[model samples]
Target: MIAEYADRVWRGESDDSIVDQGMEGKGVKPIVDGVGWWSGFGNVVAFEGSGELALFDTSSPFSAAQLHADVRAWSSAPLTAAFYSHGHIDHVFGTGPFEESRRATIYAHEAVAARFERYVLTSGYNAVINQRQFQAPGLRWPVEYRHPDVTYRDSLTVRQAGVTFDLFHAKGETDDATVAYVPEHRLLLPGDLFIWVTPNCGNPQKVQRYPREWVHALHRMAALDAEIMLPSHGAPIFGRDRIRQALLETAEWLESLVTQTLDLLNAGARLDEIVHTVTPPEHLADRPYLRARYDEPEFVVRNLWRLYGGWYDGNPANLKPAPDAVLATAVADLAGGAARLADAALDALSRGDERLAGHLAEMAALAAPTDAGVHRVRAQVFSTRAANEQSLMAKGVFTWVSSESSAHANRLGAPE
Candidate 1:
């Protein structure tokens, strides 16, 4: 099943871009006069005449400086206005370049403004933790966050340069999200609402997401019958029917996950049991637009747990857990020792048992990160496992572990 999906995704049948074209420095492509779509780390929709541009979301693994450079190449159109679909750093931090523009009016939902203020207050804590979440360097809270100059509760319309852009608030992936629609152009800019990648409604590292509200947002967008759909990330989609189908299917997918998880929860099922029993609809399982390339259904279940219930997962042991390393060391000792676990992992790898090998190797690495042989075996096992993973989300995480293991091995003078 994974292979079949990979074939479809790789055949260009799906909208997935394995390599981000924008990150490769591809200049912005023109969509309309003064108006164009910049595909890089994120999608930037620009209207040049008024020297106005609205960036959807900030792209990952790229800094605000790079995004600014990409926009500069497209139009010296002075940044007139900017909008954040949500409060995520990727959508908001890149506005530094636009902030310098004296005339730029930043727009966002009222919740977004509150999120920014929270980030400012907890900048140091976020900086330390976000690094682990994204596995990127320079994880520092953006001190100079550019707050939205214009914030609305429900909806608002901004007319500039003979273009009318309507902003609607939707509490989906984030509580404060704005979906911009250009009635004249039939273009809908849904920040994270409609990324080509899997809807991150259930990010394991983040806060609660409103799945029911998210589905409503998609239904609303579908009703708009927009001709062109510009997502916060990935390529621009054309055609009203195609756009509507994608939106509706994505919403259905989220709704299914929510309903199924809720059913399991009401049955008094445990979290693990709920995750294992709940499956997304088979049709959506292969739909390119609904693929679990980033966030998985299990995480969605957890998100649902948070939404209906509080943070507690009803698991007493996990309510206030000890440090990860402390638990890992105890587990390693139960398995005899870190070396015994490493040997077991090697055996699992030799038997082509990636799942078992991954488990054992992770324990060994965590228990003894400096062990040369352990790191060597871990790098080899994880690298091969990552190559075989189909989902981009799984592949990225495994790849991060593999690269980290290889670097650790080199540092320990392990044999290549």
Candidate 2:
């Protein structure tokens, strides 16, 4: 019921404010009389109606026990319905809290079961990618998943005593994404579908997301004119007009990117051309909420190309390109040597040509992975690139690259 703590948690406010307000560490806040959101790392929204409770997203297993403890404290009412927003581990692993609820029925899209199976098969691969993505090398991908008992195809509405819970499927962050709506309360729950930040539709390491379909999904939610939107990742958005604008504007941002990418795709522009040239609608792009905090637009563009054109990128040379070392060696030989290539990368960085700098820098490192001078220059170049990036994903990747280069220097006993 405390919006202040939720706001404080998001605004990076005082730790005492949270503790003083009785929210030890969990960021749970009641949206209305009975509706509540437990915003730990990911959100688990709760709705109390029909003399029972409906929870949206159970959160990761890491915090599931705590969530159960808190939700129980909030109301000992049995969980009538537990909605799995999508197949993401963070959203699904917490189902243990409701495992014993005889009245609670798990529900999700049909694709969620398949996603769980895939996660089980590629748990190791998922762990590595997740570590790189989050910069947490120790993060483990979970094999345990709570499969949904009730699955829907397009849409489903369940009537519980006096309230109706409408569930609509959309392909945005994941193929098995769902957005829950409460018509009576004029509230909407978009599971990572409409996070306050830019839509996470451009995940570089994970499966492909539907950018255009994401736009449609937002439009659908906007049409509801839902006064409140409880997103999975960030704080809740209140007000009908503000909610509509956030949803529509998010859709508009995606539409602009998709249109620009498709235009280039139709004109036979290679992925390289599209990635560098596609411009974001600066009017909307500069917004604090739309700022590239997580997935940036360039990755989204690359995803678009992949969706329409596959891996080929309409470039014959990239179809079955030479090995990285071979290509780097060939380029280094042409530029006189690896040292010359690193010098050129530094020059590109100086010229504010980060794209060129990154390309040439990677080539420089691959060409002479053992050379101290090359590693030093590559480290400096990538460090600069990381500093310039606004998105967390981009920064993590560039910072990791710089760290790798620095590691090479450490191994060689190079001077600091």
Candidate 3:
């Protein structure tokens, strides 16, 4: 898979250079005595002499057959147990591979069970729309949800192979998030709570996230005095002080969002106004860990609104809506033909007005996807804008759009 990813990059077939660089030659390495986030998506913690192994968060991409092959490269320790930090598909779906190797008991929060059940019921609906959300083809939600054999509500302590593993449940990026702490090793495995780049408590295209609760969860994890913090995504933090600083900063960032949202709501400001006004502090904004790579602050505010209020975004016009295509056609007709709108969008791009250019270019793409000139202009504009974007959320969205435009241009036989 890594080779295939590299080949795609070399062939100029994909724009995932960052991901490719991160994964290149980065096979699993042991942390402390036994803990490791394997070459794949999960982590493994083994007991030194007992050959006892505990796995955390099995990932997809590789089926059971493939995972078995990969696991052999690591230790041949007998799998004792599997712990799911959350009910997310990436964290649990690959457990089938481990289950086949040994009779591993699965442990997770009780809420994880409910989450799995919900996924089973809504898998079809989730599969259909997931591609659009992540801009990936064949992104399907798994229907086969393996329930946890052991479930806990708040906390659970398990001692195996002379090492004590502490599991603490807290609602963070996911409703069923669990943080595993090994006091003996001073290692903290905080699933998605600290996903390296950002907390991901505000995924714009996904389900609701609990930002306030995530902030509280981070604070709690920071207070644990753990020396090493390993996250579900990205690299690990080794020092106690560094881990504490990261967690504290992330909490402060989320707290700022929560406080700003409440202040605006109390001031009777509308949703759009609040979103425009409430900017995260510069210190938080400058931090690499807090970058909005996957989720933005606006989405966090929206999630808070859903948690405190309801689905309605306090906008009466958005309470109900006509079919999107019908409304889009009407809007296109009002702005004249899509080509004319696209020409105007090009003019906006020329005038260094990216905000307006982005809006118009999007409209042009939706309105006249077949137009070669529209696709070219949209690609160029979005690419330039993406290069200048500071926020990862904006960068990802724009880069995806740019890629889409380039794909369309290729389909139309336009020159690169």
Comparison by TM-score, 1 against 2, better one: 2
Model 2 TM-score relative to the real fold: 0.91
lDDT of 2 by residue, 1-416 (tens): 35564445344452221012224356456778787778666778887776787788888877888888888888767777788889887787665766575646888999999999999999999998878767877888888777898999899998752567799899988899988898888989988886667778787888888999999999998999897788777766677877787788888888999999999999989898999899778888545457667888999999998888888876788789999999999999999999899999999999999889889988988998898888888899989988998777787778887888899988987777
Number of the top-ranking candidate, with lDDT as the measure? 2
Across 63-151, the per-residue lDDT of candidate 1 in tens digits comes to: 67877787788767666677778877766767666667555777888898778788788888777556645566576677556678889
Rate residue 69 of model 1 by lDDT.
82
Model 1 regions more than 4 Å off? 1-19, 22-24, 49-78, 93-101, 122-135, 138-141, 311-334, 350-353, 365-371, 403-416
Off by over 4 Å in 2: 1-26, 98-103, 160-162
Top candidate when judged by TM-score against the true structure: 2
- For residues 330-381, could you state the per-residue lDDT of candidate 3 as single tens digits? 6678988777777888899899999888878777777777888779889988
List candidate 3 segments past 4 Å from native. Answer: 1-25, 37-49, 61-71, 128-130, 133-135, 321-334, 364-416
CA shift at 153, candidate 3, in angstroms? 1.0
On lDDT, the stronger of 1 and 3 is: 1
Model 3 accuracy (lDDT, Cα): 0.72
